[model samples]
Target: MTKALKASGFLGLAVMMAVGLHQFVILSGGSAVPPWMIGGHAHLGVLSILAIVMGFAVPALGVVGQLRTAVTGLFIAGQWGIPGIVWLGEGFGLTFLMPTGFLWGGALIASMLIMLYKTVTTEEAGGGGRAGVAPADD
Candidate 1:
């Protein structure tokens, strides 16, 4: 999860930098900024931060094995794949890839929900520690 978080964070940073560069290009008289470019930039940046936060929360919630793998994999895939598909599709005018982007985006959302469910259930079942509720002094 740590490694995945790092990767996502770096990818997010890269995409953000690209957004800046894109702005520069637009300022310097490049082609009009495409909607996909702006949307992808924002989505990737936010999802990357989500991935990092999830990485920390996963261990805190005691997620492990297959559940952990699924959450991590799907989150990372969504973070990278959706924006990538958008970038490629818009950049190359390939509308076919747009559906693929939606699929990945959905997967990312699913993983987040699952993580939330698992964490909530775990805490309810008296397992891992909760984030904010004070621990008993026992």
Candidate 2:
């Protein structure tokens, strides 16, 4: 289960990086991205993937509770683009931007909140500490 989710998460991050850099190409070149993301794309794609995976998976392993807490922070940080790309369009007269503003942003925030509340406050949260604590605390 965890492995599946991790794989999915990695794949999702990869796709996000690809799409993100592709936007830059589509912006500057004014052409559809071709065989692959290169030139500007290669540099940004790799860097984006590296940063996301490191930030996403570091705390999401072995300890589900910690992962939940970490994900909430990551989810929030990931929204630095929200207002500029999302809210600005929505605030005045651009309703077309509503999807990006509400759908994506809301999903990210909601999922993170659920994961955090479930893990951080659950009974099993502290039990994982019992194995090592009994010896060290005494």
Candidate 3:
């Protein structure tokens, strides 16, 4: 799962770089950049970083098995889906698809929330409520 997340993150960054170059070309050609393009580029960059960071954080938080798989899937989907939907809708004037992007964003948020909950609830080896740190001996 960690590998998948990191791969997705790198792929997203690659796509973002391409989009950024496209934006640069548009600017150099003296045309104003479209708002959607700028927004999509930002989303792609930020989500890519999130996916990469979450890859390292997940295991430390003790996410495993099916839950880890599900979170990873959600992360990948959102990492692509939100910006893809934006580009499809605004780039092609397919306004109907815009609302659906929220669903993808929601999935990403939910995945993070799940990880936060798991981290908070996870018991350390010394029975501490926090993760990653054992309680000091009395």
Candidate 4:
């Protein structure tokens, strides 16, 4: 799962870079930036970073098995879905796709909240020890 997250993060970064270059080209030609491009670039860049960071943080949260799998899946889906939908909708003037993009954002938020809840409720969260951290030898 960690490797998968990392790979997705890198792929997202690549896509974000491409979008950025496209934005630059448009601006250089005296064309205004499209709303969809702006939104997609921002979401893609931020979510890509989150995915990379979460690759390490998720494992450290002590979540495992099916729960972890579900969380990771949500993260990946949201990461791509939000921006992809936006580009398809706004770029093509298909406003109906906006709701689906919001749904993806909601899924991403839900995954983050779940991880946060697990972290805060754990013994290691209080600084005791866990998630591969060695306890004091005392």
Candidate 5:
């Protein structure tokens, strides 16, 4: 609900999108080369996970209940959606992606992005949100 949280959520969502696209490409017989960069998929996964954790932390500042609910909802959807996607992909002659890695990755990112944006924009009586400092505070 704060700017910082909103930013985190967006960043996380970006990560998720990247990972999902990567998986899709690989499954489509594109190339792991694209996904395998520096830390590679593994790294992306870890960073993305961190983003989610950090995003969750933002709610602690205020409106955490909403974030918790969002995350919980994402979790529930992931539980079924991910596996279902994988199954469908496999059925379509796809391998590599055994499960809906994209869904999980996307959800993580989406959750973080939401928090990050909220954290960055919301104003407070005092102190800066995620957008650095307010002129008044300075």
Candidate 6:
């Protein structure tokens, strides 16, 4: 759990820093900064927050295995690729990148919902409110 939290925290921080740097590029006219890029920028920022939140939630739910793997991959890819495709598109006029980015975004959203559902249900199974600790032996 600690490992997951640290990894997610670090990832979120990195994405946030990248977003900040990209903002400078946009403001300074280094990039053309298309309108859609604004959404991409926003998307990465929001995804970063989601990662951090999930980091905290994971321990409570005792989530592991395939679902964790899927969430981590999708979150990372979405965080990077979502904005990256937009950046690439704006830089080179490659409109094709948007579809791929959207797919990544969709996967991220689905994985997040899965995690949330698992966490909530796991908490219910464990008998209540908070859930960070492992459940007692039956």
The lDDT values for all models are 0.80, 0.48, 0.91, 0.88, 0.53, 0.70
Error of 3 at 49 (Å): 0.5
lDDT: which candidate is best?
3
Model 6, 1: alpha-carbon shift in Å? 7.8
lDDT of 2 by residue, 62-130 (tens): 335655545544443333334334334533456565566465456456645665555565555345655
**Runs with alpha carbons beyond 4 Å of true place in candidate 5:** 1-41, 44-56, 72-99, 128-138
Clashing pairs in 3: none
Return the TM-score for each candidate structure. Answer: 0.80, 0.35, 0.87, 0.85, 0.36, 0.67
Q: Rate residue 105 of model 3 by lDDT.
A: 86
Better of 4 and 6 by lDDT: 4
> Candidates sorted by lDDT, descending order?
3, 4, 1, 6, 5, 2
The numbered model that scores best in TM-score is 3
Per-residue alpha-carbon lDDT of candidate 5 for residues 22-99, written as tens digits (9 for 90 to 100): 677776895554322323334444454554555556555454576656754564344334544444444445666545
Rank order by TM-score, top first? 3, 4, 1, 6, 5, 2
How displaced is residue 67 in candidate 1, in Å?
0.4
RMSD of 1: 4.8
Tell me how many residue pairs clash in candidate 2.
0
On a 0 to 100 scale, what is the lDDT of residue 28 in model 5? Answer: 87
Model 3 score (lDDT): 0.91
RMSD of each: 4.8, 10.0, 4.7, 4.9, 9.9, 7.0
Model 4 stretches astray by more than 4 angstroms? 125-138
What residue pairs are clashing in model 4? none
True-structure Cα RMSD, model 5: 9.9
Residue 49 shift from truth in candidate 2, angstroms: 7.5
